[model samples]
Target: MNIRPIEINDYSRWFDLWQAYLAFYTVELSDEVTQKVWERLMNEDDKDLYGLVCEDEDHVIGFTHYFFHGTTWFDSSYCYLEDLFVEQSVRARGAGRALINGVKEQAQTHGAAKLYWHTDKQNETAQGLYNKVADLTDFIRYDIALKP
Candidate 1:
């Protein structure tokens, strides 16, 4: 599998994968949200947000989205892996692992101090794969959304 940065012409194909990812989590994202995300990814001036797609011979089979931000605790920007998804049929074929490793490489290249992400507690399948590639941190996430 080839993992690479998403390109201008890849919008539709990338959206298909994006939809699949949302479905996997049973989340509904508005078209506005979708378009905004695409715009952010397409903007070359935005260094914080980054995206990658995993391709086999014919199609894009997986994708990973991550971003960098400043933190009080670290000198280098932390890379938060916001999203990662491989096609259902392609699971266990190393595309997921490749995507993650690719992100790790990018974090290093971008001078990121760390690369980290979280998964739902119920996602045992993903946890199984994640356990192999990364250490399980003791941190628990708490969200307090200020806006509707």
Candidate 2:
């Protein structure tokens, strides 16, 4: 598998993977939001956001989207791994690990203070893989919807 930063020509392939990811989470995103996310990932001036693609010779099999942000507790920015997904057919083939490691390498190279992500409590499959590669934090996530 080849891991690389998403390029301008990868829109369709990237969108397919993004849709699969949303499907896994049982969510639907509108075209406007999807287009905006693509624009943000590809924006040259936005150093904080990025998308990485994992592909084989003939297909895009996985993707990850991440971003960095400042935090009050640390001087260096923290890396938030916002999304990760591998095609159902390609699971357990190391594509997921490659995409995650790709992000880790980027964080290290760019001097990020930390890298972290969250998975639904019911996602045991993902947790199985994650446990092997990263620590399982005890923190519980809380969210407030500012928009209806």
Candidate 3:
């Protein structure tokens, strides 16, 4: 599998993988949100948000979305990998890891201080891979919904 930055031509395949990714998490997002995300990923002017895709035989098999932001603890920006998904049928084929490594290379290129991501507690399948690729932090995440 080959990993590369997402391009304008990747939308259809990317969308299919994106919907699958959302379904895997049991989350429903509006079309508007999805469109906005696609736009952001495609926008060359948007330096903060970026995307990568893993292709096997000219087909997109996986994708990842990440961003860099300033943190109080670091002098350089921190890279946060927000989403990562690979085709269900192709798990363990290294597409997921390739996409992650692609992101890590980007983070390093941009002088990021660290790279991090979160996974559900019960997602042991994913955690198994995460455990090998990254350090598990003890910090717990909490959120408050602010309605518009």
RMSD of each: 1.1, 1.2, 0.8
On lDDT, the leading prediction is 3
Query: 1-148, model 2: which lDDT tens digit per residue?
Result: 9999988988998888889889999999999999989999989985657989899885888889999888888889888999999989989989889999999999888788999999999999999899999998879889998975
Local accuracy of candidate 1 as per-residue lDDT tens digits, 1-148: 8989988788988899899999989999999999989898889985557899999995889889999888888887899999999989989999999999999999999898999999999999999989999999998888997986
What global local distance difference test value does model 1 have?
0.91
Candidate 2: clashing pairs of residues: none
lDDT of every model, 2 decimals: 0.91, 0.90, 0.93
lDDT of 1 at 143: 90
Sort by TM-score, best first: what order?
3, 1, 2
Clashing residue pairs in candidate 1 are none
Listed in order, each prediction's TM-score against the native is 0.96, 0.95, 0.97
Q: What root-mean-square deviation over C-alphas does model 3 reach?
A: 0.8
TM-score of 2: 0.95
Q: Flag regions of model 1 displaced more than 4 Å.
A: none
Off by over 4 Å in 2: none
Q: For residue 95, give model 3's deviation from the true position in Å.
A: 1.0
What lDDT score goes with residue 66 in model 2? 94
